[model samples]
Structures are given as C-alpha cells and as structure tokens.
Target: MKTTVEQSLRAYLDDKTANGELGPGSRLPTERALVAQLDAPRSAVRRALDTLEGEGVVTRHVGRGTFLTESARAGAEAAPPDTSPVEIMQVRLVIEPPVAMLAARLATQADLDRIVECLQAGGASSTFEDFEAWDAKLHRAIAHAAHNGLLLSMFDVMNTARTLPVWGTLKRRTSTPERRGCYHQEHEAIVGALVDRDPEKAERTMRVHLEHVADNLLGRV
Candidate 1:
C-alpha cells in the first residue's frame, strides 16, 4: 500500500534526479539516511525506491545498488524551482491570521506591553538588517502572545519558509518612505486594537496589515 508520503518522497527524488545531480548509476543515500533527512518513515522511502525501480527510472540489479536510466539523467537537469510568493503567503495564511485571533483573546497587559516595546525597538532601528530583525521579532512576539502551542509552532514553520531567496529579492525591491509610513501606521493600529480587547477589530486590522505586507513585499497576493 503506497501512502501519499511515499508518493511525495518519490516525486522529490525524481526532481533531484532531473536536476542532473543524481547521475546515471548514482547510488543515492540509503533508506535510513533519507528517512532521517526527510524526517519520514522507513516504509515511505523504501516504497518510493520500489516504485522508481518498477517504472525503470532506476534499475535494481541483484545485489547491486539502483542505477538511474538515461531518461532519468535528462529529467534531472530541470532547474530547482525557486520558491514562489504564493507559497510564502500560504505559510503566513496558516500561521498569522489565527495567531492574531488568539492574541486578541489571550494576550495579557504585559504581553501587549512587551509587543509595544518590540515595536519601539523596530522603530529605533537605523539599518535595514537591524530593522528587519526587530520587525520579525516584533511579529514573533505577537505570535508568542497568542498563548497557543500550535500557533507558536506554526509561526516557526512560516518563519523558516520566509527565509527563501524570493523573500530576499522582495525585501530589496520594496521599502520606500511612503510605504514605510503606511507600515508603521498599520503596526500601531494592530497593537492598539489588541490593547482595546477588540478581537474582531484586531483580526480585521491584522488582515489589513498582512495584505499591505503582501502588496509591498511580494507584489503577489
């Protein structure tokens, strides 16, 4: 029984092979290694390899390692896809909106105070790198104030996704004076809404804040 996990493993391996990194007769890392690297189950890795051999993308000779077919080599050279803006937003969509909702309901006065402090730090930042770090920390503190373990975990995942090269490109292209003013205004609006204990207003304000980020940062939302 092939699971979706197995299919995903197979697809990822195929993609790597297509990029010309896994050449003809290349013996890939062992199943245990892949399982460790992918953080997937042993059965999933074995199943993917079996399916690949069956389809002749790779061949399994008796007592020998798997060998990539010529077609596999040609397929392997597809440039590794750069992560897309939509993918980045999908991550934020999962983590942030709900965190804002939770922060509205759960944040304490001290939590709000801490977030305000972080925002002030961001404002005081003179360099882009420093400001970006504080800006991320401010948002992360808001996520922390949400008081849900799952929300915190999701924020970590989204933060990892945000580190991609496309994000770097967007950061470079955006950030003019008017845009910076609008950003500060929205940040203050969200903080104020949370302080007001207005969950609906907080959520709405947060939605606007993130929408502006998508418009200004990625240009695709």
Candidate 2:
C-alpha cells in the first residue's frame, strides 16, 4: 500500500500536469525543488518518483532530470490522421479562443504562475526549437487553466497533432526573429488579459494571436 505522502505526491503531480506545469516530455522539478514546494521529506519525494518510474509514467536519466513519458501524455484518444498544418491552425483558432476566455474566468494562482513561467521561458529562449516548445507549453497551460477536462483532452489531442513533421517543417520555414518577437508580445497581451480576469479580452486576444500565426504560416501578409 502507498503511504499518505506518496498518494499526496501523486495527486500533486496529477494537478501539475492538468495545469500544464508538467507535460509529456517535460522535466519534473528538481527533487530539492519538489521537497521545498511540497514541504515533504526528500525521502518521500524520491520514493514517489521511484513509484512513478516503475509505473512508466516517468523516466529518469542519470545526468538529466525526470521527464514525463510520451505515452503518459496521450489523451483519451489518438490524434486523427494526416492533419495538415493549415487545418491544425484552423482547428486551433476555433478551439483556443474559448479556452483562453474560460481560463481568464477560472484560473487559479498556481495556474497563472505556470502560464507566466512558460511565457518567460519562451521569451528567453535563443533557439527556435526552445521557443516553440515553450510556446506550446504556454498555450497548453492556458487550456488547462480553463478547468474543463474534456476541453483539456481535446487540446492535448490537437497539441499531439502539432508534433507532426509537416507542422514542424512549416514552422521552421516561417520562423524569423522579428516574427518571434511579435509572437512574444502577443503572448504577453493574452497573458495580461488572463491576469486581469477579462474573459472577452482574453478571447479576442487569443483569436488575434492565432490569426496572426495562421497568416504567417499561410504566407498571407
């Protein structure tokens, strides 16, 4: 039987994933950080992580940190086949603006903290790969903040589709420093609206951001 601390740790991790502080292939916080954050003994944290590793929810590298397993990130269903980048963008525009609005209305302090963390990380990223990873994380974080499990699952499926090779190719082909800076600023605006708890503004800003992304990717000025 699991100890109470172990159960609590599992629940904590579940919450973290649901709120986008952790995701598929994302590193877990350091054991020291977890200890401090959870106010639990280091031993218990280690044991909890060990249990998760054994269950295949996470994997630990000798020199690197623990990361969520890709299999663990799958939603209730698999992504549909052969989704083009343009189609993905279209679907995102339809789904995400409402997600942002709901996030604005419902986000907890912890959710907001993680969203801001992703934003800062994306802004600080030097490489397009790093920026894109954080960009996805930021959007997923916002989706999770909506606190609707079905919407989150759908968002996760959409996000999985984004990992398709064609999507990456298009994103790489279109990437530019100026465009990246503009995206960061747009991200700030969306986050700012969420922080202010303005649902309408959050929805509008999210739509505008996605529209800009669609235009950029489709080569429409």
**Each model's Cα RMSD:** 15.7, 11.0
Which residue window of length 10 is worst by lDDT in model 2? 50-59
> What lDDT does each candidate get?
0.67, 0.82
> Which numbered prediction scores highest in lDDT against the true structure?
2
Name the runs in model 1 displaced over 4 angstroms: 1-82
Lowest lDDT sum, 10 consecutive residues, model 1, at 71-80
Among residues 3 or more apart in sequence or in different chains, the pairs in candidate 1 whose N, CA or C atoms overlap within 3 Å are 17-76, 18-75, 18-76, 18-77, 19-76, 20-76
TM-score of each: 0.60, 0.69
Q: Can you write out model 1's per-residue Cα lDDT over 153-197, one digit (the tens) per residue?
A: 556555544445577567756866566657778888888888888
Candidate 1, after superposition: displacement of residue 67 in Å? Answer: 45
Q: Give a tens-digit lDDT track for model 2, residues 140-199.
A: 789879998788767777776775669879999999988999999999999999999999
CA error at residue 191 for candidate 2, angstroms:
0.3
